[model samples]
Target: MVRELLLAHGNGGEETWTIIKDLFLKYLDDPILSKLEDAAVVPLEGHIAVTTDAFTVSPIFFRGGDIGKLAVCGTVNDLAAMGARPMYMTVSFILEEGMSLEDLETVVRSMGDTARSLGVRVVAGDTKVVPKGTADGVFIVSTGIGRVVYPGLSSHNVRDGDIIIVTGTIGDHGACILAAREGLDFETHLESDCAPLWDMVEALLKEGVEIHAMRDPTRGGLSAVLHEWARASGVSFVVDEQSVPVREEVRGLCEFLGLEPYHLACEGRMVLAVAEESAERVLEILRQHPLGTNAAVIGRAQKGKPQVLLRTAYGTHRFLEPPMGELLPRIC
Candidate 1:
């Protein structure tokens, strides 16, 4: 076995076959993928949701998760937000030559474990290697396919009186990535909230929660989801600033960095708009899940021009601006 990766590993020769058989297949064995064909065929019914995402986080490894986990969860969450049950995925890797084989194995193993726990199949993949300086340590791209279980979940579905609910504390992912990259030391450590959320959505569906629109706040945090929804639906969201949940550490880090936590990213948490009548019951169902212990009703959609209004604790409301330009690099 090689201690480090070499360009030859991607040459589709002996080294390439050895790496595939020994590492990827060893961890991510799937009946459909075992056929080793150019494309995978699987059975599916009803509406299907498919999404693709690429993970190039600055630090390959972080406090809570690595790139592998991010790639899988990010893709799966995209499908889940569409009210889908994730079924299959394909992974492709771009590796820099001289990368550690052990790190590669660890990443591959994590991808397998996360997919297995989520009942998603890793159906197909490709590997390519670049010169040491030509690419980051590693980058993984995953495409997910899921069966739509709860239909009509869309950004355009948010109603004027719809209630906005956040699944948990926000900004952990962006803060965690920022700190990890900057080497910031804090008394209380922060970790990325990277996680797969199919179970949480499934739970809400099982309980008959009326979900009009759903989004997993990622690259641009809750603000992005709300702004996009507002733009799509031509509605405004009145968010109570005090009601937004943020970890003490995350808040502190954002304060020190002069950053808006609302504009930061969250990987594990979700933002949804539901019927006013079902708001409390939806919160109850969400709170029942381990991933939603910090769930809260942050705001409500209102009839207005497309925008987001932030009601500060001081009792003044201001238009929350969308994050402009590149806020951070390689965060998710």
Candidate 2:
């Protein structure tokens, strides 16, 4: 019963919250969330950016990371994607009754370590236990609060002629999750690319690069994110297939599986739009970070049909559409 009223762990909006009008709490009203503050004004200072995210990847644990680290990093990354310096997070856990305490402790410790590494604190949290069949092994809901430092930043600010750059390889997280879940044999191992991006964003800002837009490609992958920006900014985009970074292993796996790399998920990757002149500086700044070592200029904004056009390696172009449904679902 409780699970039905909670937000599901991924970006699909699978779980929906309840609305008990008769027993409505004063805090759940529009007046509260509309305040637009990071947290309730119990005792905080200044303005902050706040975001909530839940995690429920199938199998719970993956090759490079588990649900614990992914939950914390997912929220923190959202805040960073908004150009905010993350500070605090509130974690809530939904555990199945028969789950082991030892495993729970390990997940908690992983969450603690991930939060600490980002210089953030877990100020508050909640836990609820449900019957075995009522829930997945476990689910985590994280609400992140970050202080906004960069001003006038958003994907809505993107413009035509802006250069689009991506940090590192795409489809790693999705491919890794799928590879492990299916127990597929491959020549190389794929790991989840999950991490915080605050440091890289800060360093890029120092380079005086004009960032028109930025986003972490998670559930819907680069294809969804690009289509989103194209619609929001009212501009067309051209992506060179050969320019976008994809590991040979991931490429081979996707090819064998009849999957599209651009439509695959990427947890630790970001796409940014910057002025043509500022693109080089942004690339240089990104290259300095271990996370951005494989960063490359993959596309450019153009004035056309407000759609995504992919330039194939053989001098052919085609429209890139959003995945019909979950190609690789719950791969956050």
Candidate 3:
């Protein structure tokens, strides 16, 4: 029986199979994964959306979710942003020596639970054990494949007169991690907004919403997404500063820490560009879902020089620049 992960488990020998067959397979069981083949064969139809992501969050476990859950949600959301339906996923893990088997099992179990709930399968995986201190406790890389149901979605598809809507409040995930890492105390508790978003995206498609562009505000947050859309579509954005939704606790933390909430990452939020006429209807649909109850229309796009302009509560306009430098390293 495996008690702890060892280098021999990654040496391409009997121990490796024992751990994979006994532990990983036991948790992530599926016809594709059960084949024990070098590569998984999956069926696909229509255009496919493929995305890969690596997770290196310092504190493996955090409020609302852990590294395992983050790895799955991050990849799933990437495909969701493309208006795709998630189907299959491949996971790889790097484990440090002396890592507890119980902890590894917990992580694997979390991945399995998330995959099942999202109606996706973990069809293939690999594991490696590195010498102690040579690697962090763990790192996960996931690759996802999705079937594109709604086609023609592009960042360049955004046009003048399109309204911008965010699925929920921004900066929740980033602030949650920061507070957890620093042991900061506040009257209100902050939790990461880590979650799978394909269902919410599917709802929009079902309603026949005309989606011009969509992106999950991840590493660079709201500022990054707006700047990217502005540059890609060659249009300017007039954002209402007061209209952008920010949780009271998140706003407080950002103010106390001298951080801009718009620059902080969100794991479960989507920034959308749709026709102005459909903006309110889209927001109405989003609010029906638990994940998007706080959705808001924050801005409108117009034909002008490619840049984002923020109209502040004080009635002043200023350019909203893309975030530069590493705001929070290993924040994904």
Best-fitting candidate, scored by TM-score: 1
For all predicted structures, in order, the TM-scores are 0.98, 0.86, 0.96
Model 1's TM-score against the true structure: 0.98
Q: Over the stretch 270-300, how does candidate 2's per-residue lDDT look in tens digits?
A: 9998899899989998999999999999999
Shift in Å, residue 58, candidate 2:
1.5
lDDT of 1 by residue, 35-149 (tens): 8888988888889999998899888888889898888899999998999999999999999999999999999999999999998999999999998999988999999999998
Q: At residue 78, what lDDT does model 3 achieve?
A: 95
Looking at model 3, report the run of 10 residues with the lowest lDDT sum: 179-188
Best by lDDT: 1
Alpha-carbon lDDT of model 2: 0.78
Worst 10 residues of 2 by lDDT: 16-25
User: Between prediction 2 and prediction 3, which has the larger lDDT?
Assistant: 3
Give the candidates in order of TM-score, highest first: 1, 3, 2
- How much does candidate 2 score in TM-score? 0.86
Clashing pairs in 3: none
After superposing candidate 2 on the true structure, give the runs of residues whose Cα lies further than 4 Å from its correct spot. 1-43, 185-187
Give the per-residue lDDT of model 3 (tens digit) for 61-119.
87888888899999999999999999999999999988888888888888888998988
- Cα displacement (angstroms), candidate 2, residue 217, comes to 0.3
